[model samples]
Target chain A: MTENSLQVSSIEFSYGRTRALNGVSLNVEAGRFVALVGANGAGKTTLFSIVTGLYAAHAGDVSIMGHNLRAETLKALGKMGVVFQRTTLDMDLTILQNLRYAAELHGLSRKDARERISEGMKLNSLSDLGKRKVAGLSGGQRRRVELCRALLHKPALLLLDEPTVGLDMSSRAGFVEHVRSLCKQYNTGVLWATHLMDEVNHDDDIYVMARGEIIAQGRVSDLLAAHSVDNVTDLYNLITEDNKNVVESGA
Target chain B: MSWLAALRCLRGVITREGLRFINQRGRFFSALVRPLVWLFIFAAGFRSVLGVSIIPPYETYVLYSEYITPGLLGMIMLFNGMQSSLSMVYDREMGSMRVLLTSPLPRWFLLFSKLLAGVVVAVIQVYVFLLVAWFWDIRPPVMGYILVVPALVLGGLMLGSLGLLLSSLVKQLENFAGVMNFVIFPMFFASSALYPLWRMLESSVVLWWICTLNPFTYVVELVRFALYGRIHWLALVVVVVCGVLFLGAAVIGYDPLRGFLARKDGGPRAG
Candidate 1:
């Protein structure tokens, strides 16, 4: 068995002549949380798409819990959960219905689905809002509902693409803490992609992406030290700015 | 996924579609209204001009409403098919499609389940239209109604599969209205929905050929015959074959590799 819950190796993807992902590779071990920080159009969403099986990579492999994505797609997907950049909940449905549907899509029986949904709602502080329509929920509430939906099946790896965008400061902090606790409690691997520097912590593994490439990856402290910087913000600036200069000067 | 699991997913998808249809009351009213207006108003006005020959299940000359009732039934499925496609475009744009595609089941099972769900909704609309037509005194034989079930299912699947194929090709919701004009109108007009193929042949042989070539024409004919307690074998074969072909293409269009959605984004590109 592989230690990595999610492994993306040398994956390349292109849209016409515009390369969306250029030999990008990363891994998340079981029970570890990795933060992926990148600017807009930095291929974070593109990489997420490939890992979620929404798009095929031009080259290389993605494995979820030791199942190769392309060769054993069903098995691989069965072990993964995803929270897309945009909210995907059906606004017309109640929170309960949304979670129930997600459970069924993952092939859970009704009896099992009911139990899991109730447990998920309870865990996410969404127990009272089960009957309420998702459209009526606050942004933070809806995001929490999405998290519950993704976690209902007890996926081995949870991939979130900027899950906290449009959230308030307090809600963002709440979300970060909740996700951290969930990861520890469930022993689940998580790859959280975002552009916000504050979302990442000192001890977390940080992968900085730019121009479809993983330019730097390490603990925040190590990254900062390697760049001769004192903090995460400075390290981010140095790497992205340095990559841009190299590209611009070469072009 | 296990067969039972696949069945569960199908149940969920179908239930969601049913709930969506029920929630949108306006859509229900409109889906029924269009066919009713055509049956009550258009058929009445055109009855005098369009004379009918003694077609099977009719020993005597029939009313235009009766003649076109089956065609109108086909029309319901046609419009619903396109509406389902429009919903697909909307789903894709709103990001819900990603959630659906990421399900752990086989991709083909997921796509087929979605198509089946749409067909179920269209069939419900079709039955409602038939009931209203019966209330309007455009009644078929009681046995014809019973036999029409299989025909409606087949026709619904055929048209719904075509919608699936169209949805895979159409990228944006804003561009779908143009597709309605180009695909829906041409399909509805070029088929035997409003007029008999003989009438089309009398007007122009070219149109008659086009009508003959259109898959919609076969579905319309299949429904027409089934509603009269008869079977049109050729049309049945044509509709089934077309359904299979369209469904196959749609599954390919949704394939993770080389699929329309997975291919180039933003604009069209040459191979």
Candidate 2:
């Protein structure tokens, strides 16, 4: 049986009075790339935090590789790799040291870690920068290092949270292409969370979130068709119009 | 997870902390200089003013520097513990801690490894201070140096565990100043580190009781005895119990469901 690499069901989370995630749910199956598109305050990060076990959900079930996150946290987390919204690399350490730390954290043997780091560095065209401190790397190089780190463990599921926020257009395009290639090459499941409209391709599966709920989900083309719109921006404006009104009125 | 996996994780954390300690020259110098100031300048001022009677660890009358060596070592561990907590909060803010927390290990094991790594670094600093005190003629028996390693580890564990717990309580770097003032200063001053229980009793009964109640007092006493090739059984038991409690509390404090990370509005603290 083919199991979803990630399955988040009816997850709810709150910060005292503010409900950040309200009955949110989604899934990413093996070998498929799924985009979780949302506005700035659409609860994408909150949901990701819960799924990654940063914060326990007030209510919900999250399973990874058919393993329940709460009951089998280590097994669930073992099958995944995550690139958080911010740069998590230690600026003080050299690129090689940072990656080695991640590799060791994932429990790869010395031989395996060395082989995989070499391959990942080569794959990201970061071979020459291994000895350089992460603080000296450009934004694009840092992001590449992060991607290499995330893939070092060969995770079955990869989660990226707004990874290309500050990159230039060409760098963003290159990063996206590289991630897509990695997904197809390894048959890895991907949940790419972003607020940018340009990142979602016409044929890719997408989930549109607003105000802590998934308002629409399907292939990009299908979502446009279902909403009787011709483009992503129009589709977003049409679906989130009510949410905007509610937020405006509440404010 | 398997034993090899855990060992790899432990090695990784320790290496990272060790590398950080090596790279931070200011930190290294300060860790040495802080205790040396007390040993050289402060102890010299107090040598004849406040003499130490024949303590168990010392067969005859010991000079002020000799009496305060174990206390200075304990102070090193205390400051090192507080530094670790400050960095934990800073790491939480910067998002590096997110990567560590999400690693595929038991949370308890990950936390314990972090504690052990920090204590190991502090132990090295303790030894360096011992080397400095050697020049000051505060030398103990040769075996005393070898045996003091275990005592330092035990004392470091207790202090480091407390640091881990404090990281969860004071979430912001700005608030850490208060922690140093409140936790470090009070613990350092009210403990047996600076003076003996007898001295405190001579000063005031209430002050003596406060020193006796302080867990850091037991840590100092434990290190003091171990450095002389002896064991203070009472101090040993107290340190062990306090270590377990602090580690347990720190484990819970970092817990996603039940601890400080459970339901916060602004999220984790900033550096």
Candidate 3:
């Protein structure tokens, strides 16, 4: 029951014949960003599903804020916020309505929910868009709304899976910066999963998955130095070798 | 979860459902229209030949509309239940079902909350139909209206649980339409909803058995008696047992939790 932001150990998950994740383990401390990079079917979403309690692991343990996800699913998941790859926001509802639903789901009091919604909206540059419909927002603004909802209850850990997949170049960078700055200020631990290399930073910790295993782990620079590669792509190429599913971003 | 948190989560689930119903104006109107057409257009003609008499709930001969009223109520809940199930499948695919699952509440309770929310929506729709049917002189004693509430609650729970089960099993939207055709239509037509079991037996003993075996028949019969200030003990038991069975299956069918643990193996894993 130690207050580790996230501690996944010896996790194994399989969907019939295909093992999605195998003996994968990682940790994130408060206020740190860790990028999980892998190709499309590399099990990033499966691992996130297991960690967020969306899917049960065949054999493993996931701890969030000292709470074991299996035995204390409610407490563990309650302490974690997630942005799934798909859009969860209602296109017809106002942003406030969407955020309020999350607030209530997390057991926030009326006053606390109100305060957080207001404060979060302002912090996320969503104050003016409170009454706006999600359908009208740009791709990036929509992602921001999802991010805002994830933060409404002030979870200890934030998990975002392929969050910037559809955004334009500038929008993608803006989202990465937005998450980094806000999550840092709140001292929230982050496990951001993506295939895009540019969305990651040299200073950030990294975990590269291939064929359901953690092929590499360390800071982006450490991974590059260890593999003797100058770039993320080259590092991925060297590590994965003939494994067809490699990192996507040329950046 | 504390009582207050649990209550708050339930309220949120119901409110979200209410909002979705309101936003879909076409669906709302279509639900109302479907029952009205079945009661007035398709059913009105078949009334003369129904030959219903001394049905336990009907001490004396009753008009076709009066005999048909409770069945229509059952039909409304049945379709509403399936509609809500369709929405669940759609939500699991493209919506915030994942977000809702992240709630710290026990997974079973969250699903029950969803079932209850769906029941609430169905009951409202049922009442609206009844109110409209009143204009056509379709109702029972003043007390009948009051007594029917609990019956509708039970009936809604049973049918909604069945729908929940279907939602979990149906992989794609295409399969759901088949369920509606195979499950819903057969359950409605083969049961005592449109006609009595005796009439079905008179026509075909095999059809009668099929009607007797359908859980929806018990649901309809339960509503039939309860609407008239009585309870059919057999129907009551069958409905209760079927409700429990369907809900249990649905909770297990849901993949978010230990549902997968039920299987030994076999299904392609997708990212």
Candidate 4:
């Protein structure tokens, strides 16, 4: 509604009888980095899936850059890139080949794809490992390669689903920094899904989801302040605690 | 929509499949071995027991192994196609399929590209097996050798589409072995894969009708007819019809909404 980078209005999804996303709605402005923090099964991945055209939402609408997701999936997807929660890289392929494959899927020429891949690798500090098989790369390095692959086609909106799931402290910090730098440098709207509180910067917009709903949404510091919490972890705990209590009390 | 884009996607799919095949050396060897075992040991045992009838497609008396080579080729494609689809189900379970399915390319094209990639691999394996057949002095006509490429491609697509159809319907990898045992083997055997249709007719009219009805039989017959320097229109029609039907079923099976395969419980919820 805001002509923002992305808009999800009243989306509902279910896995059989279990409702995964219930009336979920959110908006992300152009070039803004929005952190979606939630507990496991809190519908963050479900939301990401809908936005990326991986799954269709049953009860609402999603738009990317003014294109309706249902009506113009390819057009919307052309303007977006997603790094799934799992490693999608061909483990047998070299990092270069994987990136090239992604680029080709997006319709780039081989020579052009090669150049863009190199640029992407350089952006992610993975230029040195282009020729290495993904199977041999460290978890963090594989994550970076996945990120590089997502960015190969210069997508306007980049959706990363738990990009730092299994990384060490240093690697997580390094990866987050690279992500922030990419968003800033390229003016790419980013919706980063993560359960880790430490990854949410104070200035960034935050959406705290629990029980298939967004319970809190604002700048990280503002939401934390409004909730009278010291940090994201405490705020998350408070929201999830309230959810659990509601469930127990049948409210 | 552009041809260039489609071509690029096609290349990507083929390269990915090729890389996967190269990485799994043991699988390649085993795929080769399954067909060879039938060609050498099983065929040798049955060669004397089975009397040869002069079928229209056969110019002279052919050994059991020679007669079944095309069928074995179909089996190789059949198995390999299923293997590729099995990997796709694994990819879905492991979350890799989400990446491919979410790409900007149309889902149907993406799926067809994957099928084509399987076809390419199946054709390669068939050629390798043919070379070995040649070494054993089992040669189809030279022109038939060339004709086998397109025949193999059609057969590969038909089998590969069945694989995709299975992948879409079967959510878990564990269920696939059951499919192989119940569906694949029965389909292969019930058809004329091991013997000629006339041979089947002598045994039972019902069995002959079943073989005629079975699409796999047509694929095998098509390959067999081509191998012997003859063209079978009925077989070709059946193969083409089955291929299109299976591929259509696969597409419907994978539809985002209203597809039983797309329905799943638990795991990371996508939308």
lDDT tens digits, residues A20-108, model 3? 88999999888899999888888898888788877788887899988998888888988889998889888878898888888888888
Which of the predicted structures, 2 or 4, would earn the higher TM-score when compared with the native?
A: 2
Candidate with better DockQ, 2 vs 3:
2
* Chain B only: TM-score of model 3: 0.94
lDDT of 2 by residue, B1-271 (tens): 7999989999999999998898898998998999999999999999989898897988999998899999999999999988887888889888898899999998888888888888999999988888878898989999998998888889888988898898888767798888889999999999999898998998899999999999999999999999999999999999999999998998898999998867456573110
Give one digit per residue, the lDDT tens place, for model 1 in B159-269.
Answer: 888988888888888888998899988999899989888899999999999999999998898998998899999999999999999989998888878789887484211
Docking category of candidate 4: medium
Error of 4 at B43 (Å): 1.9
Candidate 3 per-residue lDDT over residues B1-271, each given as its tens digit: 6989888888888888888788888887888898899889766887786657887988899877778788888988899889988888877777577888788888778888888898898888888898999898886777988888888888898899999999888877777999989888888888888888888898899999999999989988988898889999999999889999999988888755567322424221333
TM per candidate comes to: 0.97, 0.97, 0.94, 0.96
Better of 1 and 3 by lDDT: 1
**Model 2 off-target regions past 4 Å?**
A242-251, B268-271
What overall lDDT goes with each candidate model?
Answer: 0.88, 0.89, 0.84, 0.84
TM-score of predicted chain B, candidate 4: 0.95
Ranking by lDDT: 2, 1, 3, 4
True-vs-predicted CA distance for residue B109, candidate 4, Å: 0.6
Best to worst by DockQ, what's the order?
4, 2, 1, 3
lDDT of 2 by residue, A1-251 (tens): 66699999999888888778888888898988899988888888888888899889989899999999999999999998998888999999999999999999999999999999999999999999999999999889999999999999899999999999889999999999899999999999999998877887887888888878887788888878887878887877777896678779989
Lowest summed lDDT window (length 10), candidate 4 chain B = B262-271
Lowest summed lDDT window (length 10), candidate 2 chain B = B262-271
